[model samples]
Target chain A: QQQVKQSPQSLIVQKGGISIINCAYENTAFDYFPWYQQFPGKGPALLIAIRPDVSEKKEGRFTISFNKSAKQFSLHIMDSQPGDSATYFCAASRTFGNEKLTFGTGTRLTIIP
Target chain B: DTAVSQTPKYLVTQMGNDKSIKCEQNLGHDTMYWYKQDSKKFLKIMFSYNNKELIINETVPNRFSPKSPDKAHLNLHINSLELGDSAVYFCASSRGLAGVRQETQYFGPGTRLLVL
Candidate 1:
């Protein structure tokens, strides 16, 4: 079973536009939600993360809006640039236990100038 | 310095051949993990080791085995490689123990394996 589900397998946005990707989770035990960005031929890197306690988190132009009640979260990139063109993955994991991450399928984001 | 590194950035082998991929971390982390990203870019955890001890072993095949020589090194050995095994394998490490919450995981550049 896919504990974490992501929508829009691919996305395209013009430069300076807002790019959004959404993800939903089925496990309520998940407390840590993180987003990873990966470029071609490289491994995924941590972009931003949020906890259940926070409704939203902003790091520069990147923002993560989390809704614990709905078991959903979304990533918003303001002023999306060509440099931001990469694959984005949303992951969830519990604070305790094995703490293994459950990742979404992934979304390939393209920023066109 | 590279936080995490893997050997043979690209591996092309024939089916039924046995192959291995090595991973090492220099971030003084105690936990290491192996994740496979398929063609569709779906990333899944295969195994995890904490302090040279096995912790998380997902529903992977027996042909795939993970050995941790020490907290800094984790190696993956695959027997009888198949075409389905063609994907990019990533190694990651975190600071805390397996049971503890370590949110940040540093990943390697990834080893792209192609089984012909």
Candidate 2:
């Protein structure tokens, strides 16, 4: 079963526009939610992360809005640029010592100038 | 310097052959992970090691084996390779185990394997 589900397998946005990707989870045990960005031929890197206690967290132009009650979260990129074109993955995990991250099906984001 | 490094960035082999991929981290992390990403871009955990000890082992095939010579190195050995095993493999490391205050993971450039 897919514990975490992401929507819009692909996305396109003009430069300086806002880009958004959404994800939903079924496991209530999940407490940590993180977003990763990957460029072609490279490994995925950490972009932003949020906990269930926070409604939102922002880092630079990247923001993560999390709703614990709805078991949903979304990533918003303000002023999206051509450099922002990459694949994004949303993941969830419990706060255990050795928990493995459960990842959502990824979204390919494209920022056109 | 790369934080995490994987050798043999690309591998191509015929079916029934055996191969191994090596991973190393210089960040002095205590945990390492192996993930497989399919053509559809779905990533799944295959194994995890913490302090050179196996911690998470997912429902992967028996043909796959993970060896941790030390905390900084983890190797994957595949036997009797099959066409279905063709995919990109990623190695990652963290300062501590997953879910420990949401430790950020550092990933190495993936290894693309093609089995015919």
Q: Name the weakest run of 10 consecutive residues (lDDT summed) in model 2 chain A.
A: A92-101
- How closely does chain A match the true chain A in each prediction, as TM-score? 0.97, 0.97
State how far residue A45 of model 1 sits from its true place (Å).
0.3
Error of 1 at A78 (Å): 0.4
Q: Write the per-residue lDDT of candidate 2 for residues A2-112, one digit (tens) a residue.
A: 399998899999999999999999988889899999999999999999988889999999999999889999999999999999999999987667888899999999999
Which residue pairs in candidate 2 have backbone atoms (N, alpha carbon, C) closer than 3 angstroms, thus clashing?
Answer: none
The CA lDDT at B16 in model 1 is 100
Per-residue lDDT for A56 in model 2?
96
lDDT of 2 by residue, B1-116 (tens): 99999989999999999999999999999999999999999999999999999998999999999999999999999999999999999999997764566488899999999999
Interface RMSD over true interface Cα atoms for each candidate:
1.4, 2.1
